[model samples]
Target chain A: EDKVVQSPLSLVVHEGDTVTLNCSYEVTNFRSLLWYKQEKKAPTFLFMLTSSGIEKKSGRLSSILDKKELFSILNITATQTGDSAVYLCAVRGGTSYDKVIFGPGTSLSVIP
Target chain B: SAVISQKPSRDICQRGTSLTIQCQVDSQVTMMFWYRQQPGQSLTLIATANQGSEATYESGFVIDKFPISRPNLTFSTLTVSNMSPEDSSIYLCSVEPRVGDTQYFGPGTRLTVL
Candidate 1:
């Protein structure tokens, strides 16, 4: 079975603080790892990490994958109240048609 | 990325009844996935609906309980059968674009069974 585990199930931080969320996976033939942000409805795509040691960034949110360690981390710098949401990590296996295995997610709350 | 939409954004159904949720995508997609999100939980894959074949269900899920239909590359439906309180959840439909691995999601159907 493909499994993905996330650390720090929940966190509380103030604005301007930085936070790092971790995700580790155990899957056969690992293909790619992705990060998503969910506020209320649908999850918004964040980053997709396919190669190790390479950082993918979009504004204040950036993520990097460590294939050697089978883990990934999402970093939110200068966090704002709007950044408070659930961060989800998902992984896809080789030969799978985008069938992603999702982690339990980390709930973040940013206080103003 | 593709735009996805789901019908019946929410509903409160009685036990023993069933609800069918619809999903429509703006463009053709190769894979459509159904997921269930229980309260305060992560999304669980229910099945993978292909264009011309039977949907492949994941472990702990069955066709009898969650019948799915994929009539074409741009549309699909998921029906929750024999509803119980346990069936109450947020059902989301996702589509992976033909050009990328990113999976876009619909607004989701929030079903609340009493």
Candidate 2:
């Protein structure tokens, strides 16, 4: 079975603290890894990492994938209360067609 | 980037009822997907709806339980049949505009079964 696991199911941090969320997946075919932020309703796209070693960043958020280890990490710097949300990791892979599997997600609460 | 919208943003229904959720994308997309997210659980792909073809459902999800319709590239609908308390969840619709592209999600419909 294709599975994606996330660490620290829930986390609470004070404002300005830096946080790192982990996602590891085991699938038959590895295509790409994606990170999303779910606030209340749907998840918003954050980053998609397909290559190893290289990092994708946007303002205070960044992410990287390690194909050799079958894992990925999302880093948030100088986090604020607005950063509180459920961070989700998804992997897309399959031999015939695109198949996406999602992790349980890491819920982070940034308190001011 | 694509803007997706889902309607009946939230709804409450009694057991044994059915509800159809609509997903509309601003631009033409190649593939649309339906997913279910139970409270405190991860998202599960229900099926993949492509225009001009029957939807392909994932294992454990059958077409009878969740019927999908894709009449065009930008529109799709998912109808949940025989609702129960256990069926209460957030139904999300996502689209992959192109192959190898990041999927974008609609706002989602929150269904509460009483």
Candidate 3:
């Protein structure tokens, strides 16, 4: 069974604070790892990490994958109230058409 | 990235009733996925709807409970049968383009069974 686990199930931080969310997974054949931000309805895509040590960044949010450790981390620099949402991590494995398994997710609250 | 549109954004249904949610993608996609998200919970894969085959269901999910139909490459439907309060959830449809593993999601349908 492919399973993904996220750490720091929930967190509360004031604006301008930085936070790091962790996600680790165990799968039969790992293809890629993806991150999403969910506010109320649908989850929007954030980043997809396929190679280790290489980081993908967009504005204040960045993520890196460590294939050897089978883990990944999402870092938010100078968080804002808008960043308060559930961060989800999912892993795609088995085959190219395999289903994605998601982590429980980290609930982040950025207070103003 | 593909754009997905899910119909019946939300609905409140009575117990034992069934609801069918529709998903339409702007572009043709090889694989479309359906997922269930309970309140304050992670998204769970319900099934993978392929263009010409029966949807492949995940563990803990059955075809009878969640029947899916993929008539084409860009459209699919998921029906939640015999609903109960416990069946209340937000159902989302996702599409993967070109098999790179990045998935784009539809806005989702919020179903509340009372």
Candidate 4:
């Protein structure tokens, strides 16, 4: 079965703290890894990593994938209360249909 | 990224009833996916809807329980038949405009079964 696991199911940090969320997956025919930020309703797209050793960054949020290790990490530098949300990691794979499997998610609480 | 919208943002229905959710995309998409997220749980894909064909359901999900229709490349619908309290969840519609593109999500339909 395709599985995506995340570490530290929940985390609490004050403003300006840097946090790192981890995502590891085991699937057949790995293609791409994606990260999303879910606030209240729907999840918003953050980054998609398809290659190893290369990092994708956006302002305070950055992410990188390590295909060799079968994992990815999302880093948030100088976080704020607005960053409090559920961070979700998903992997798309499968040679026949390309199914996307999602992790349980990391609930972040950035206190002001 | 594509813009997607769902009808009846939320609904509260009685048990044994059924609700059909609509998803509309601004641009033509080849594939549309339906997902169910239970309270505080991860997203579970219900099925993949492709135009001109029947939807392919995921494991544990059947067509009788969750029937889907993709009339065209830009619109689709999912009907949750015979709802129960356990069926209460947030149903989201997503689409990837093109291959290798990020899948964008709709606001989602919040359904609560009594």
lDDT of 3 by residue, A1-112 (tens): 5789999999999999999999999977888999999998899999999999999999999999999999999999999999999999999885444668899999999998
Sorting all predicted structures by DockQ, with the top scorer first, yields 2, 4, 3, 1
Q: Which stretches of candidate 4 lie over 4 Å from their true place?
A: none
Tell me how far the alpha carbon of residue A67 in candidate 3 is from the true structure, in angstroms, after superposition. 0.7
Q: Report the poorest 10 consecutive residues by lDDT, candidate 2 chain A.
A: A92-101
Summing lDDT over every window of 10 consecutive residues in candidate 4 chain B, give the lowest-scoring window.
Answer: B95-104
> What clash pairs does model 1 have?
none
Better of 3 and 4 by lDDT: 4
True contacts kept of each: 0.77, 0.87, 0.80, 0.73
Compute each candidate's TM-score over C-alphas: 0.96, 0.98, 0.96, 0.98
Model 2 segments beyond 4 Å from truth? none
Of 1 and 3, the candidate ranking higher by DockQ: 3
In model 4, the Cα lDDT at residue A66 comes to 98
Which 10-residue window of candidate 3 chain A scores lowest in summed lDDT? A92-101
Least well predicted 10-residue stretch by lDDT in candidate 1 chain B: B96-105
Put down candidate 3 lDDT per residue, B2-78, tens digits, no spaces: 88999999999999999999999998998899999998789988998978889999879999999999999989999
Model 4 lDDT tens row, B8-110: 8999999999999999999999779999999999999999998989999988999999999999999999999999999999999999888657889999999
Q: What is the interface RMSD of candidate 4, in Å?
A: 0.5
Winner on TM-score between 2 and 3 is: 2
lDDT (10s digit) by residue, model 1, range B8-45: 89999999999999999999999899999999999999
Assign candidate 4 its CAPRI class.
high
How much does candidate 4 score in TM-score?
Answer: 0.98
Q: Which is the winner by DockQ between candidate 2 and candidate 4?
A: 2
Q: What does candidate 2's lDDT look like per residue over A1-112, in tens digits?
A: 7789999999999999999999999977889999999999899999999999999999999999999999999999999999999999999986566688899999999999
